[model samples]
Target: MSKSGYFVSFEGIDGSGKSTQARLLADHLRAMGRDVVLTREPGGSPGAEDIRKLVLEGDTDRWSPETELLLFTAARRDHLERTVNPALAAGQVVICDRFADSTRLYQGLARADLRGLVDQLHDLVIGQDPDLTVLIDMDPKIGLSRALARGDGEDRFESFGGDMQRRLRQGFLELAREFSERFVTIDGNRPVEDVFADMRDVVGARLP
Candidate 1:
């Protein structure tokens, strides 16, 4: 809830329902007569969308952890420049499905150094952190199973195995601890309507 506008982010492991919650929040705001923009990381802007396909679907045999981090940040930079910044400048609430926090959790904890280059790059890419970040926390096994059941072949990253997904979940918790003021952990295993109700309460209290 900056003077400029709200930059709220939703974070969680795959199949944690972040996208669904983000859309629900945006729709709630719009119904209340507030202008809102709902977008996602790695594939928001056109340039970022192309990069996303390469990062998610392209060959990863040659891709190192650092390379993965760099690609995600590049997409974030483009997304911020093209979509997020413009929407916020126009005083619209920008609800992003994922942001730098995802990079911190995925690359930082699962792939790369949690204390090194990836964290530094995250700081650089997201100069000012999100006004609020709602983390839809859930069991990694459940989340991954849900993702697999949705019928998309495992991408390079998603195919990292169950242990990595568990680590990534811990990584998100670590981030929430560090940024307690901005991070809200929500139990995502509940029914969709119940989760939506909690999300509305959180957003309503913070949004102007």
Candidate 2:
């Protein structure tokens, strides 16, 4: 499990621009001659990508929380084994758009109180956390609105509506506090350049 590379994950509500920021950071790192692998949860490796379709592009009631948790955990295990671990072992920076934290909020709190289950599954299977987690914090209403506007067929989570988003936003903040050692919160309501500037500065300070 020990690796020489840096592992960074971006976490936020559906449309908080975490994905965009993650990509930008990856590009910046690569431009600086750093070896970087940019990937996303539930869909990083081939097997995980297949699982992603089953979980992301369906009705809001596609699966029960417990079932969803199992599916996500399965996808993550594959993702970590095939994608993240290999990249880190090769001494490359692994930039993930969203990681275990998303599941902690979406399944653990948003749908029901499953944090304890989430942790148990994570420790039992995943057994890892990112070296740095950049939380793109933003207003839930705005994030959901932007997410729904994407028309990307990944709106199953956004379909839960504003209330769930509000709860998720608060949940993310609490998580930031809970894992303050590696969690860095950056406001996502600002312009792309402004937000990216902060993100770049934060990561640059921590990069090995």
Candidate 3:
């Protein structure tokens, strides 16, 4: 096993600009001559990508909360085994659009009672976490508008509406407080360049 690389995750409600920021960070690091692997979830590796479609498509109620968590955990396990771990072993910086934190917020916050289950499953199957998690915080209304504008086929979550997004935004902010050491909350309402500059500084300072 090798542990010579940096692992970073971008997290936020849908359309929070986290995905874009994640890509920008990867490009910036690569420009500086760093080995970087840019990926996303609920897909990253092949196996995970397959699982992603199952969970991200179809009706929002296609799977029960419990079943959804299982799919997500399985996907994450495969992602770590086939993608993230290998990248780390090869000494490459891994920048993921979303990681376990998304599960924690999306599923856990969906139903207050399921949070414990989410944490337990994570501990059992996905023990690893990103060294740095960049959370792009913004108003739910604005975020949802942006998310809907994208017209991404994966609207299962985006269709949850503004009220749900509000809950998610709050959940993410609370997570930031709980995981202060490894979490950085960036205001996503700002210009993309400003957000990227802040993200670059955050990741650059901690790059290994």
Q: Top model by lDDT, which number?
A: 2
- lDDT, model 3, position 28: 90
- TM per candidate comes to 0.93, 0.99, 0.97
Candidate 1 overall lDDT versus native: 0.83
Number of the candidate with higher TM-score, 2 or 3? 2
Worst 10 residues of 3 by lDDT: 105-114
Which pairs of residues clash in candidate 3, taking residues 3 or more apart in a chain or in different chains?
none
Q: Which stretches of candidate 1 lie over 4 Å from their true place?
A: 1-3, 58-62
lDDT of 3 by residue, 1-208 (tens): 4499889999999889999999999889899999999999998989999998998888877888888889999999999999999999899999999999889978877644588899999998888899999999988899999888987788888876888899998999999999999999998899999999998998899887
| Candidates ranked by lDDT | 2, 3, 1
Candidate 2 lDDT over 1-208, as tens digits, reads 9899999999998899999999999999999999999999879999999999999989988799999999999999999999999999999999999999999999998898998999999999999999999999999989998999999898888998999989999999999999999999999999999999999999999998
Q: For this target, which candidate reaches the highest TM-score against the unseen true structure?
A: 2
Give the range of the ten consecutive residues with the poorest summed lDDT in model 1.
150-159
